[model samples]
Target: VLLGIKMSPEPLKKKHGRAAASGEKRSKRKPKRKETFSVYIYKVLKQVHPDLGISSKAMSIMNSFVSDMLERLAAEAARLAHYGGRATLSSREVQAAARLLLPGELARHAVSEGTKAVAKYTSSE
Candidate 1:
């Protein structure tokens, strides 16, 4: 038995221009430059630790930390992707990057080991 269904096919409408097809108004506005990794990390830390006031010294240290981490991650990600014939990075690749950026050999090794533990846990689930 047929249910209560309207099975008539609707007519297609033709579009006039590219904007009409996409339904967005194209503008001459240029995209804004993204804030660096340092800027973003600073903003988040500031929010969480409000008493740690934003100062040149604080900003300088935090910015340097973030910049180093991001740069290392980028380089490691590129290397990993090259082996796979890809030119982009994954979250795991970013972890490798973070490990590379850590200040001391001990810290870097610790981070790498931690990352493996995390990956194992995530993959198991």
Candidate 2:
């Protein structure tokens, strides 16, 4: 008003949540999801197609696929261990499980990858 400019009242700001709902400790971050494979899935997808976007439906299917794969792998590994009379599971059982569950080249690749992971883990320890 001093400089001949009209000053207008600022529009009211709307805040989310209750004004008087006190005593609750809330975090600004999203809660960690039960299925924590989202990061891995996104990384794998990005490796194949950097510019590609995943739909929620496709992501759900991917999560289900990962869950099924893990279940089958674990079951097969446990079965192999049980049959071999071993009280503990080892890479051998996992390799055999992969061999039995996966087809041909995929099985071979899985064993190789598992071997690498085991080696890395052991060497780190």
Which regions of candidate 2 deviate over 4 angstroms? 1-33
- Clash totals, every prediction: 1, 0
- The lDDT, on a scale of 0 to 1, for candidate 2 is 0.85
Please give the distance, in angstroms, between residue 55's alpha carbon in candidate 2 and its true position after superposition.
0.8
Model 2 Cα lDDT, one tens digit per residue, 1-125: 65986565894344567462454344576878685577799999999999999998888888999999989999999999999998898888888889999999998898898899999999999
Q: How do the residues 1-125 of candidate 1 rate in per-residue lDDT, one tens digit apiece?
A: 24975454774465555454464455566889856555676678779996776777767787787677567667777887788787677766666655665668865785768678888999999
Taking all chains together, the TM-score of candidate 1 against the true structure is 0.42
lDDT of 1 at 69: 58
Error of 2 at 74 (Å): 0.4
**Deviation in Å, model 2, residue 94 alpha carbon:** 0.6
